[model samples]
Target: MKMKIQFIVLPLITLLFIASSIAYAQNKNSAADNRNAIDRMTKELGLNETQRGKVEGILSAEQKKVEAVFNEERKKLQLIQEETRSNLQAVLTPEQMQKLENKMRQEGSKNNAQKK
Candidate 1:
């Protein structure tokens, strides 16, 4: 029924999402990278303190907006990930599930280490 379908689809979705996030992270331009653009503008334009302050305010506001959007998307992704894990438990054999859980834990730790 619906539950069986859910279990079968869950693993595929998880794999797809993991691959996509890896790709996205590799290609993404983070807000920190904006520092270079800001600096370049200041140098090329000879911005005075007043103009520089205005530019900083605009950039800061834009960065906040980007962060807000990222957070909203991340929340959705977390919900999907949780659902995937719950459904996968029903479909995978106990041994298979254990292997998957261990792999996920390893990857999680690796990601944390990389972040630092």
Candidate 2:
């Protein structure tokens, strides 16, 4: 039971950390980053209005694709996390599961506070 808990919880925590980091990065940069890239290209390559418009469209499409991919991956990760938690609940006693929930909540609060 202990080993199973460790195995499931460790990977779940790792996935959550990775997902949070990716979300934070996406929120921080976003569309402005795309516009900045286009601006840089326009300046460096001396692109005309038509070329600039095309590049903007390309960037916009790329951003949408990337966001879609991340969203899909995020949904998959969430499902995996939920499954792992359910499995853990099956393995653990009620008291142990409650303890685990409290620990996770505390950790989440710490993470949220740190982010602020």
Candidate 3:
């Protein structure tokens, strides 16, 4: 029985690991696409060699700054979202909350599809 249980669990775990790896690869590809878009924009702006180097450095720094800001904002937004959800649960009817959740899920799906 233990061997049979291990056999069943092993395949399920392997499948989940494969699925997660594929998802991570997709995210990396999406980030590459975004970087390509930035590079294309930089090329179109016609910077000279020295200017290009400086611009690239500046852009890299800005990207890091923006990422930090985004991380901070995301945490704050998550907290607000949790609080709002809690308040809504207390004050809103179940049907209203369900509608809100459906709307949020739809928006999230649309955003994910757009990233792809």
Candidate 4:
């Protein structure tokens, strides 16, 4: 069970975490949050129309660049995780593989319940 967790459950959880992070990074609320931040900054600094516009542009560009990087990295992480699972499958016997799958499903269910 320990080895099953170390080899399978941990990686599965990591993949789930990374997937959720990617989803959050791509969430539309990020744009709204950015706008709110800029609005606060403009109010506090008494920025002129032109200054506010420039600041918004700068932040929007920065956010796009950061999101692109995050998406690219997330893809790489998923590929690595897939390869790890494949390799683990190759190493384990059929019975062990079934057990690992069952354990993974249990863990996934537990995580989902916790989230709810």
- Each model's TM-score? 0.63, 0.75, 0.49, 0.70
Q: Write the per-residue lDDT of candidate 1 for residues 25-105, one digit (tens) a residue.
A: 633665556677678889999988898889988987887787677666767777877787786787777786777777666
Model 2 residue 75 CA deviation (Å) reads: 1.2
What is the per-residue lDDT of model 4 for residues 19-39, given as tens digits with 9 covering 90 to 100? 755466466467988999899
Give the C-alpha miss distance for residue 19 in model 1, angstroms: 7.9
Pairs that collide, model 4: none
**Best-fitting candidate, scored by TM-score:** 2
The CA lDDT at 32 in model 1 is: 56
Task: Summarize candidate 3's per-residue lDDT along 20-48 as a digit string, tens digits.
Answer: 44454544455565567567766897656
64, model 2: CA deviation in Å? 1.2
Comparing 1 and 4 on TM-score, the stronger one = 4
Please give, for residues 17-66, the per-residue lDDT of candidate 2 as tens digits.
56766675794577999989999999999999999999999989988888
| Model 2, position 93: C-alpha lDDT score | 82
Spell out the clash pairs found in candidate 3: none
TM-score of 4: 0.70
- Candidates sorted by lDDT, best first: 2, 4, 1, 3
Pitting candidate 1 against candidate 3, the one with the higher TM-score is 1
How many residue pairs in model 2 have overlapping backbones? Answer: 0
